[model samples]
Target: MNTLYRKSLPGTKLDYFDTRAAIEDLQPGSYAKLPYTSRVLAEQLVRRCDPETLTDSLKQLIEFKRELDFPWYPARVVCHDILGQTALVDLAGLRDAIAEQGGDPSKVNPVVPTQLIVDHSLAVEAAGFDPDAFEKNRAIEDRRNDDRFHFIEWCKTAFDNVDVIPAGNGIMHQINLEKMSPVIQARDGVAYPDTCVGTDSHTPHVDALGVVAIGVGGLEAETVMLGLPSMMRLPDIIGVKLIGKRQPGITATDIVLAITEFLRNQKVVSAYLEFFGEGAKNLTIGDRATISNMTPEFGASAGMFYIDEQTIDYLKLTGREPEQVALVEQYAKLTGLWADDLENVEYERVLEFDLSTVVRNMAGPSNPHRRLPTSALNERGIAGDDMLAAAKAEEADGLMPDGAVIIAAITSCTNTSNPRNVVAAGLIAKKANELGLGRKPWVKTSFAPGSKVAKLYLEEAGLLSEMEQLGFGIVGYACTTCNGMSGALDPVIQQEIIDRDL
Candidate 1:
């Protein structure tokens, strides 16, 4: 351990590595300009890396040098069933190979904490049109996954340092955001920033809490579980300066979709982004999470926000213990990871975006980054007034349009974690219901939020039934429309399509 920089954390008994002291000693005044990413990484290096190579690794961040490989030991590893199962199965294969060579197969166990959540692959066989969709869907999931689930159960007992969360719990990313990340971690009487790696790209969702989290491939996650440090050169640490406030009634989803397109155009492929400025300050942690969760869409490794009052507020709101929350704030401020501490930080590339300039936006028919204004269908000659008139008239006359909206889904996991979007949706649904609007017979509709808490609040607000009245019922979790799994089309619609060949 590099005890040279170890110091007492004033408010807590746990000791912390003084990253600022070490950095300033190396290069005077350089510590003040380190970005949030650098500060967290440098802390890890100071606390965990071999003392012999610590100075060189610290130089990788202090000088913005990307030539040499430094080691990154993420504090935790998270996974979803799809990739989690695959990684575990690979371990089993390795164990077999090791046993063949007369190696101790039992000794080959994960050293780092691993949490596997079975969520992503849950197929929505039962559409939300049915009142009992959640139960029916889970029943189908259990029956079909009977064998795979048996293995998952076995994995729970067989694997060391691994926790298996069965299906129907919630989305892995959401669970991580509200529960898994601590923002600050304490080990062996030493406190440092929490860092994590998840097999899924949306892993950055927890970055809203100021944790240094990155998404890795399945193999990378497996390697991490085996306690292998991620070998890395520094990525382009880009800064996104958010300015202006979001217009009234503009949801975080709207802002994120716009930001996703903007970041994609900036060619920030594999960059680590830090969002800050007045606009970012105005955003709630929920808003930051929405943007960070879409890291994959922007083709970035992470979308980070610094620890600030917002991060503290979110921690408390999500039910984190008071002591832990205090530790996060104190640690962040002390180690220069706090938002206020980053005013002088510099980035290789900086992008400026205006929150007010963005219109309420949505993505394309295929891509999340292919942003479009909600009103663009007419301008783009895709859906004109004539088409709308014809569709309404046809519906009234009991005739089906050749092209129809077959699937309607609230699939991006709002209402569970994001109250603003879901509340707006529920209000809209209530208005539509009051207007006697109903789901089209040909459409299979579903509402899948990441957490069940969404149901409680929506019910309390009398919006759940309002949405359900329009066929936007609580179907199940993990019904993401972006993933090509928004439940099956109605059987009648399928038959009609087959018969008409349209």
Candidate 2:
């Protein structure tokens, strides 16, 4: 019997089952209609469920039943430096606690493979225009993070089933999307899909590959890391239909900023956003990656695009060996995971976003959903001769300006996944330098690519020198400014702002 059963406390109704039999025994051809996420859940349930009550539990998803609790076993855990460091710290504390009791401290280790990438620690202390900006900024990072780094290094040898990808490597999400996650994982004589829970809110960036990656809070990741199942009900799956081609020069960042605003307005929080239609099909995996990477910024749990030729193309482009790529293609096709296979897939709710309508945009001040059009900068009071004059006057007086651009950085997996944005920033920097439009002296700028590949491409394009000329040098490959580790401001500038409250 390929069934599993469990009994919970009174009033609790979580009976777990494996999906293998559910797919075969439920309505014929129903498994193909399930989302990739559901398929993964099914695989885990079948493998781990006890033999007594499998079908009863499988009937819940297969029949759209919603009243039961199911166990989901993610294949692994991925984490960024800030949260990952904190997580390990907690575990160390737990280890001490466990040792105090009769429990063995060494016995407390991650049950599944866990990868902790050291990113999110550097901050831009120098503008991109400085010739020694990269070296200077790195020095500051090492000094500031000595405490965190010491603890992290200890974690390397102290924990079992945990791997540390050292800092100055790249952003965690980009590294995972590019090099870490094998679309399919083979272990212990069994082959299964690769699904994971990451500490940051943007862990879903790798979802572009049809993986069921979701970002969870550090607290939640701790639970999963300790071998507890993430219990939750079925999410509202929302289909976002994209249409029309983007206008020339429109970056994926621009589109995602706009889409993020639109989708949030449409209320997609905690929903699974499935990008479909012609616009999605036309998008390169890089562009798709840019969108999926912002899944958290848009308040969705996962932003998934169907696996298709583009997905295959990206695996090859990123230099994955042929055999692995072949396995991905073969498995996806055989398992009905291809884009064409999901054409008839149904969703409870759907919305539309037009790629053609998107324009160059930036998000922030305080929120990722706050999309700001560059054209509206003057009208929106973020740009204007008056503000510029005030800023210049403050500079003349040796005072920091109101609304000064304190940090202008190129960081985060959201924007870093696309080479276009990186190249664009470099090109703009080059043009600005040629035009004598240097960054305000108060602005701290840095460039931290998520992978070494970006450096190669930028150098090949001859834009690295231009970036350095503007003081946007590589500040060690890491998440840097995006994770709130924007390095210290110039002491003088910081004092001026503090003294004057500017």
Candidate 3:
């Protein structure tokens, strides 16, 4: 530890590295211009890097120089089963090599904290309409992946600094957001901001809580697991100023879909975007997470918001201990990390967005960034007007429409993690139920929230059954449709596939 910058944090017993003072010591008033991402990165360098190279490395950030690569020591590595399994299998191979070379195989272990979540492999074999879908699907998962599960469990016991949340828990990203990230991590009587590299691209989901979590490839995850510095250049830290409130009836999904289109068009590929202004402040943590979860869809590395009261509020809401929560707030304010402290942060480029301009939207016809208005999804747009008229006429004669929707899945961690979005969906279902309108007989639908707690909340709100009434019952709390694990299609649709030989 560099004692020159090490100082006792007030209101807590833990010591924290004074990143602001160190940055200012070299360039007065420059710390104030550093974006949130830069501040977090600088803190880690001050706390972890060699004193000899500290000044030169920080100067790289201070001057926006990308000529040479710096080092990033992420605090943790997070992984879902697919990529995590591949990385662990490699480690197992290395252990064998070590034993053959007369080295202690048991000594080989991850140097940094690592988490592996067994979430992605589950397929929804049991229909959501069945009340026992979750249990049944989980049983099927265990039966099919019996050998795979055995290995994952053995690795958890065999490896040091490794923790695993087994299958049927929840999506890895959601678990990270809800409970894993401390916001401010304390170790060895020292406190610092939490940062992580995940094996899945959507790891930025937890960036909603103001942590600098980003996704990396399988090899990068393994490197971080070994406590090696992830070599890097400073990303194009772009500032996004959200200026207006969301219009009435507009959902977080709508806002994200619009922003995804805008950011993609702005060519913010691989940039670190720091969202600020009144509009960002107004959003709840869940809503911010909804946007952050879709970071890759915008071709961005991370979507970050400054730590503020909203972050603290979310910690409390998610059942974080009060003392730790207070520590997070105090540390952020003292370290210039609070949203209020970053009024004058500078960015290489700034993008302007107005939330009120967004309408109810969805991605369609092709890619996730391909934004399409829901209003335009009707007959006059996708299908020809004359054909739609004929289809409607045919439907009136007690026949199925020519282009009826077969699947209406309410899925993805991107939207379902946001309470506001789910509540709005539930409310719509309630109203539709009251109106005596039900799901079409041929429509196969499911609702898969990223968190298991979603069921409790929806039941308390009396909306689960209403959703079930509309054929949108709870499926397994895992990434299904989005991960290509959507199991068997409806039987009717399957038979149609067979008869289509006509």
Per-candidate Cα lDDT values, in order, are 0.86, 0.79, 0.89
Question: By lDDT, highest first, what's the ranking?
Answer: 3, 1, 2
Tell me the tens digit of each residue's lDDT in model 2 across 113-178: 889998777766655566676677677778988998899888999999899988677888888888
Sliding window of 10 residues with minimal summed lDDT for model 2: 5-14
Which scores higher on TM-score, 2 or 3?
3
lDDT of 1 by residue, 418-485 (tens): 77788888999999988988887788888888877778889999999998888888877763565676
Per-model tally of clashing residue pairs: 0, 15, 0
Give the top-scoring candidate (lDDT). 3
| Candidate 2 local Cα displacement, residue 354, angstroms | 1.1
TM-scores for every candidate against the unseen true structure: 0.96, 0.89, 0.96
lDDT by residue for model 3 (1-502), tens: 5677999998678999999999999999899999999999999989988888888889989998887677899988999998998899999999999999999998889998999999888887776677788788889999999999999999999999999999877899999999899999999899999999999999999999999999999999999998899998889999999999999999888999999999999999999999999999999999999999989999999999999989999999999999999999999999999998999998999999999899888785358888888787664366567777987796688665656776677888887888888988899999998999987766667888888878889999999889988888887888898887878877766676466531
Error of 1 at 144 (Å): 1.1
lDDT head-to-head 2 vs 3, winner: 3
What residue runs in model 2 are displaced by over 4 Å at the alpha carbon? 1-21, 89-107, 384-402, 495-501
Model 2 misses residue 364 by how many Å? 1.3
